[model samples]
Target: MFELSGQDVGEAQLLVDGSRLEALRGTRTCARWRWSPGFQAGETEFELRLPDGRTRRARIVTDADTRKLTRDDFDAMVRDILEDTFALFSLSPFRRAVSRGAGGPVPPIARLEFLRTRIGELEQVVARIRRAPRRRLRAEEAVLPWHKARHATGTEIVRSFRSGRVLRENHQPPRLPVQLRGHLPELIRVRRRTDTFDLPEHREMAACLRSWRDWLRAVSGRLSAASLPGSDGAAWAARLQALALRVERMRQEEPFAALPDAPATLTITSLFRNDPTYRDFHRLWRDMNLGIASVFGDFLAMPLSRTFELYELWCYLRLARAVADRWGVEGDGVSSLFGVDGAGLTIASSSLVLSAGGGWRLAFQPRYAEFWTRGDGRGSYSRPMTPDIALWRQVDGVPTPLVVLDAKYRVDQGLADALTSTHTYRDAIVDTKGGVVNSAVAEAYLLTPHQPAAGGQFETLPMPDRLFAPDYHRAFRFGALTLRPGMQAIEVAASLDAIASGLES
Candidate 1:
């Protein structure tokens, strides 16, 4: 059984001896099936490759207990979902997940005051020893301190307070991330949950929870991609995940009637229209702390994931637009490339950027669409790709420099920053590896954003009217910069140009 999920653009596969089995559809949601493979159980191998790049494998032994089912059952169940079943639709990866504005600089998870208190206790001992007094005694006094109370004995008279020191207690680093501990209890608890199918309530709650988990995971993957921008993007991803987990935890705790039936008549429209009646209706939603209905309820009724997905698309589009506006990559053309699901951004960056600048070729592990079935580059892309943005050089003899670049967006970056935050890192280029490490880059026009001139790979030289403004050089304003949004295109061209110059040098 192979479950094909993701934006309907990409596909997921399950293989048993490198072949597809179609009978697993019934178990897609809950694969509570007993397997008795004819091949001496140990001889048969089972493997699952999730939509994400994570893969798991196991083999069955014919002699072992036949009742137990591992992830293969789950994988087969998921594979069966491709049967075109259920009220399926793209749940946007960009939906205003949880209110990201709640927590301030304080980690929202747990407080660490106890550990701080222990460190303070150890410091007191050290302070007392340093303040100890030393008084010398007369040699004629009794040898032992017990013999002389009034007269000082040599041994009892006085001594420096520096005999020894004891080791101080040091606490272990907390496992709780600045924001993850709160969700940890709930997320871990649901892992081995049993389905009380016999109960009407557990059945409904479990179903909803499972769907919610898959939906959250998909969107989470999108934000962590190269183009989208957000503060603490990864942290927010976790927080959103925490939100999903909370939903499941709610279901797990009560299993049924998790939310009091405040209002059976749900109207998504009221949220957008400022309807006072709808706003006051659902206390369950309010109790759960989801105020978003007031702002986006109308959109929620329409498949929350798809709207969120579009938001992510918009974010990338905005980013690409900024890049284009910055570098004037139009002459280069913008074509999309879809690469392996978990392959680094270099794959797509290599595919699209190189072709924009002409003959500077770039190759990548092809895909129908890397991020999702609906992101800008979806299934519309060609796999085992031909030149995505085929190039033809402007100058006849200028040899193009064929360079490949990658976009690195760390997950935690989302955890710490906001969507519009600047892209600067305090890290200096102390460890410059091979290649010319630039601490700064400047063009005639605007300076790069959030970084010094030396923004790597992403920096676009200030292009004149072609991109920025008509009188580009005259309007040049230097300042802190990050990689040029449009630099991928220019980089393709500049790298080739640099190669040409190097050849002539």
Candidate 2:
């Protein structure tokens, strides 16, 4: 059962999915309702209808509590996945285009989110720099009298002798004429070592902070001008303004305040290479230049409702990388994975196709409709089916499905339930040629984030050691692979190799 509550009910009825609950109980100031069967682990809608024929609606997101992932952990996982995906695009043949920002128009929302995250990182870097900024002992020439000329350099002494300013046994002041004996009658120029914060690296950092603040202001203006559907532009602009103010405040702080303007060309110094804070600052500076708009389109708005979808995309990308490593990507194969649109650089999520050397191909979210009835002569026997990833091997120009993988953003028992879809895909999807029916897919597998326990009681479950056995895979031609975040490259490659071994000749 589920309970819904709200304030100022005032004779209003509660509805779940447009159905009024008969067990509603409430007063004019408060209301409550109980519904049977409870809610699922995803997004749901709730509405309250007033007597004045007005209705208020809200979307409630329910996370899968069984996973026990904290908010920070989830955020870190998502960030890692996105950064990895972006790295792939950068390393591809289109690296030049990505570097030049020539992919397409960047969305204002993407820019706003990008700026916000980078600004936060910059703040952290600045905090570290403020704690222990780079400094050096600077020598300066100063005019001082006898008692204060303890650090008088040899050059200053020679200059004083040559100028006839140093008098023996005279105590006259530096600027006053003395008729009697005085020691060092005139002021002597001395060289003193003092700590200074004026360095090229510090100047560059200060300038970077200022530039980021100005960039934030410019982006805020652009966002205000652009019309965003279902978004409050004023609120976003206000938030950006606050961030800009923070950057400005940082610029006016201690170490940064003493630095001069950065040079037109900043030269890399030893401090940048040796100091931890400087190294971190330099890395963040370089990373901020690489815009996410050129690779990810509107991905900044990932809410709890779309966590599963995000996980699916992450799994496909990870598998795609593994496939590339295993078979070696062919020429220009990576270019087909991205496209340019009005919003920004768009990933070919639904219909991406890639080719590897030696007659190997991969597809993301490709549809297998009832193509047997069509002239093309391919697809499923019943209805359409779209799998997250499909691996193929071309034999004499005829494509054969080598492996089918579906990403399930689930763990534990949910992963077991997802195995049923792989079974359906492997069975219903077939190839018919010359009135002969044959199974089109050689093997089907589910990719999940579930990590099975090591020698535990749950070993009797489907995800135990038996599921990963080579004999079980060869006999059944179906299993699930654990491809969760934080997995090393070698582990992912091993999973891909297992899938490759399932090829039926």
Candidate 3:
């Protein structure tokens, strides 16, 4: 994966390798690309030969930013990564060659030979798994769940400052110290260095990298030997450590190897709501948010490109929800896209689709919330496509947006064909998961509530509007960026209209 950043300033037209590749954003900015289909052929190279004489280059191989997972969790992650990265082959590696030598130059006979070789190489990687060892974390890495530290220390607001707190950064203006004015550009340079990274990550990395390259070279030394130049990452780390130690030792022995240093500050907010002992947990946010970032930002490097967004899901959702709430002018109340009975109107859809993915369960409160009420919130009426809406804390005390969508509901093929569109404005999606996939039904409905808060009575008159009017930024702001609630058969279509209202800032 490579993030191609270049500005064709003063150019009248676009050009790639002296020939046209694709147009840029109004003015030329930057682009990102992944080595397409036949990745094995180009495994040893990053440069691409466009039609013209010049060349496009390989930049990076980024792993989607991952959380600090438990041993079992990390193992699962590794398995998934391996499956995705190596699954071009058949269930058995016999048919994996075609996807490998894709862009490589070779005749049919040679391609066949390459495929055979790749199969052997894969077997070496998997079969060479002599043992299932415990995965470990290093000093610089930490995926501390925001909630965990908050719970452990009983501090909802934990702040870390490098030197001072007032000089912190925010979406608003960042305060730079007068002492650091001379090094601002250097600091930015340091930050950019972490971008194009696909290297060793631990103490044993250098040796392992060396072994890996040597092994690959020895195995395919003739046809294609994959040489990893920056391979022994562990060794590189060791080298840097050695140099630092030497400096430190010299400083101790002779007191003047140190130079004057300027200081910067880092202040971070632990939590917004001061909920005590509420351990922040995550099984899905990292992947889901990251994948969404990849969608429009860079289709080719979805996983790699969106890693940062995974860590920033909170910000993204906050912005997205704000945009969604302000799209339409009128209407409010808990509304379901599946049906009007806000409680009976369930969020009937798969657990993985963008429209329905991400868990929507809140503190299971029924006294104030309508989704959990006895008589289905769909108001005494029910339809085939009507979703199951679990009335939640919809009262003034616990006012916030919610669309309770229980995904495990078992229904017939005709029923499941209804609720499957993230495009809240249009309801053209039909469920592809029939009974064959899973007959179990989840007892919740996707909410298309007019406002972030679930309940607001509209003009209590004729059936012109079905739900309560939602509060807005003028009154209360919903916490995240999300598609608004809408109906399906009785799909409320005004849920996500604010997405285009410039939410990215």
Candidate 4:
């Protein structure tokens, strides 16, 4: 599978060194190797050229088990990767202490937290409504029998269809007795009411909670709808069922009935009327909508495998921890370095600044978007240039050198592209008001899954011992480092140790 020959059992010529060797179905030979084609990793198929101008298709398999993948394994890997990603930054030192909750996995607990938090907020609103049902004292005019009036004014006349008699009269032209038939403002107590609900907030809150509850039920019901994969399949299904039951209970305790037949405009301002409770209601509404959209709607359908795009995210998080540790910081210190930015799990373009003392700081930008490069020298962007990870720091608001790291999910045939792109990344120059400065892309690295050392062709790329030389004037180049997906954390830490130590020295 690692050769570039065309013949089934016979010999063929190599592309790189032009040597001849036997081509086997499941084995590799040095004479049949061509380093020029480069190595491709992961689940990709490529064709190898033959001396007779024919091509043979081959697939590169990295996982030991190439059989059908199970849903449980997929879910577990997703959860593991995401958990590691979130651990890169804690919300606050006392977030868990104060809120009785820590960060959660992107898909499962995080999504659940969103639901729980929104529900709690809605509950508070319900409490407020129950405490002070919105009401108003209004006025209306009506002709009533004078006896019903507690204190009626003078009446100008009282008639019995024959003759009129003054029940009470006053010398003042406008001042009549209590028996007067003149119109008067009657104060009426009007309690705000919808169907069984009073305020529009009540109706909207009920509708929102009902929708969320329905969504939860639907999701939970899906557990029995199909057979799930993984060892935790039954357990996960049970958990879902339990959550559904809880939601059912919550809905049963629903404070407000369904919305009225007539529509009501439920504005936060009208609901709380500048009351502090307005914040709670608005925040809950926003969170409920966003949580549903981001978690269940967006993230639920994502697949977990070597092919997932989040592989880069996982890599960046692990690398961040490794880099911090390599800088002589561990545990809380490492956590603080990245958390200084206060942004949480920004997958593509996350920026962080670490104060390293002595007027020095270390800044990192993962999936750095502002890194622009001109690949073909045409005075225009020949191709898009965004390094998977970029590291740099400024002292006293002035720009310094930068280091760019790229995560290559597969590096066999893609290794050449990674190398070429990384070099172009090296040439990226940034202009500042102080002056136009070369980004001084000091070092560039291509991180990929570890192929066995027996396959030596991938490791031949040039890497300097001193990646971040104190001199900072050396020409830039990329080094190929291997990572193990099965043991992601260990491999990532090991790779960063090698890369960061070189850079720091």
Q: Model 2 Cα displacement at 398 (Å)?
A: 2.1
lDDT of 4: 0.44
Runs with alpha carbons beyond 4 Å of true place in candidate 1: 1-210, 214-245, 250-319, 323-337, 340-505
TM-score of each: 0.21, 0.73, 0.19, 0.38
Give the candidates in order of lDDT, highest first.
2, 4, 1, 3
Q: What's the residue-level lDDT of 174 in candidate 3?
A: 40
Worst 10 contiguous positions by lDDT, candidate 4: 97-106
Best by lDDT: 2
**Predicted candidate 2 versus true structure: per-residue lDDT over 1-505, tens digit per residue:** 3343455555777765445666555566666667542313344457778766887888676554664332333443455545655655654676444432322343334344445556667788889888987787998877777667776665675566555466666333544335333445367777778998887777887887777677667656766567364255654665677788998999898688967788422357888888888888887675555433355543434543345666666676777777777777788777777765444456665777777777778788888899666564668888998888888888788877659988876777676667778888899888776677788888988887777655323335455445545556667887777777677778888887777765534
Which is the better candidate, 1 or 2, if ranked by lDDT?
Answer: 2
Identify the candidate with maximal TM-score.
Answer: 2
In candidate 1, what are the lDDT values of residues 1-505, reduced to their tens digit?
Answer: 2344344313344544333334344333332222434212223456565555776776544442232222222212122221101101111122222221222222111111111122233234323322431122323312222212334322322231123222222335654334333222211111122333233322433454344444445444553452235344454454455545654444444323343333222345533136333233232222222221111111112221122222222222333333333334433244333221221111122333323232333223122232124332212222222211111233364422221111212122221232222112111111122334332112211122122232222234342112222222224311111222223434534433422332222
* Alpha-carbon deviation at 185 in model 4, angstroms: 98
Q: Which ten residues in a row have the lowest lDDT in candidate 1?
A: 82-91
Candidate 4 lDDT, tens digit per residue, 1-505? 3443223523444321112224433433232432322222233334456545675655444442322222223333344444443454442242421111122322343344335434544666656655655443444544444445554333311222123232433355656335444333332222232333335566665565566666655554554354455223333454455555654454444345443532222455655556656556665665555444322212333333333344454455566555544453322433433222222333323444444322233444423334334321211123345566665544466544556676665534545555676677666534333334445566677656535233223225333312222232233345666653455566666665555453454
**For model 2, where is the 10-residue window of minimal lDDT?**
99-108
Q: Candidate 2 — what's its lDDT?
A: 0.66
